[model samples]
Target: MTTLVRELWESGYMHTQDIAYIRPDGYIKITDRLKDVIKSGGEWISSLEIETILSLHPSVADVSVIGVRDKQWGERPLALVVLKPNAQETSADDIKAIAEKAVERGIIP
Candidate 1:
């Protein structure tokens, strides 16, 4: 057996490397992965959640969020985005506006 298969067999469960939360409704919500979560000002930020919010924008084709060093917050999320092929008019401010809306809605803290 391969190393990965053997490890899984020994562990009895596959390590998906995902982090989740069981909500008050008793539903499981997959937040993000251990490696993908960003620690900012002692708070955990889900990169996947940010990506999901950014993807809702019409001009966003693809997006990835990563943590970057910040003096004040310890770390901050940096979004790398790919605009739609016809999205020549979309600016960085436009993408930022989407995230700002999410903050206003309390979807992101």
Candidate 2:
């Protein structure tokens, strides 16, 4: 992980505006660096982490996770997703709720 992080920074391949990458191995790779990550409340809330988890849902066709300013935590990760076509039963909130449930189940949280 350290090596990957170093390469990511050194290669200059990631940006704040880029989208996240979801690997076939069920690992979410951060394709962008948004604001150097949020360091508040003794926790490093990585946008990539949130993106990866949100993207695990079957409905997400494309996803990008960004950190937004917050008064309490200084920053909070916002998951922006693009759904696949022909999605008839799923909504944005539904995907979020599913992801939240996954987290609660200790599968992603």
Candidate 3:
């Protein structure tokens, strides 16, 4: 284990629990692992992707996406959101609508 850790450390990947790819330009693009992915109806969804999309909403201050068991889809994404400061009028439906728009835009499955 020590040797493996040393090898990873020497490679400069650090303690990231994510998969990544190196681009031709030497840019490293990190992606979520299978364990962090949400599988629903044979579609692979990234929780971080959902969170990123939700964070774009003007009223959204913070957000997290998790997988919940679903009777039909097997698993569904549940968004936990916090509203921005002084944004008292935002409702759950409003947040849902923002996510729906992201789906339409192909940002998230």
Candidate 4:
């Protein structure tokens, strides 16, 4: 019980493992899980957000994002995607283009 208590408060806050942000309208929006967040160059990148964006592609049957070690950025996102069986024409570049567009639109960084 004591160990569990310590683990929960190890970060000085209760470890709910939830990542959330407060919008300008004063509403709190829960974004992702802390365990799934990628810490890169001092910025928090939500893996769930990336997966959600990638899943929007017509060819993407399923998608997941995970954090990988990076010497410079500390951590970087690695997307694992599964395309639709009939969408063989969809290339990796096509998937990347979607993410790039999201970046240009300030949707993800």
lDDT scores of the candidates, listed in order: 0.82, 0.65, 0.77, 0.82
Candidate 4 Cα outliers beyond 4 Å, as residue runs: 1-34
C-alpha positional error of residue 17 in candidate 2 after TM-score superposition, expressed in Å: 4.1
TM-scores, each model vs. reference:
0.67, 0.57, 0.65, 0.67
Local lDDT at 106 for model 4 = 86
Per-residue lDDT tens digits for candidate 2, residues 1-109, read: 5643444355665434455788999887866453645565556766666677777788788777665556687655567678888667878788789667866886543
Candidate 2's C-alpha runs over 4 A off are 1-36, 105-109
lDDT of 1: 0.82
Better of 1 and 3 by TM-score: 1
Candidate 4 lands at a TM-score of 0.67
Per-residue alpha-carbon lDDT of candidate 3 for residues 1-109, written as tens digits (9 for 90 to 100) = 6654464355675543456789999999877553567889999998888888888889999876766667688877777788989889988888889889989999888
* Tens-place lDDT digits, model 4, residues 22-71: 89999988787658788999999888889899999999998867676677
RMSD of each: 10.7, 10.3, 10.2, 10.6
Tell me which residue pairs clash in candidate 3.
none
Which residue pairs show backbone clashes in model 2?
none
Cα deviation of 28, candidate 4, in Å: 33
- Per residue, candidate 1 scores C-alpha lDDT tens digits across 1-109 of 8654554345685444557878999998878766778899998988888999999999999987867667789878878799999999999999999999998998888
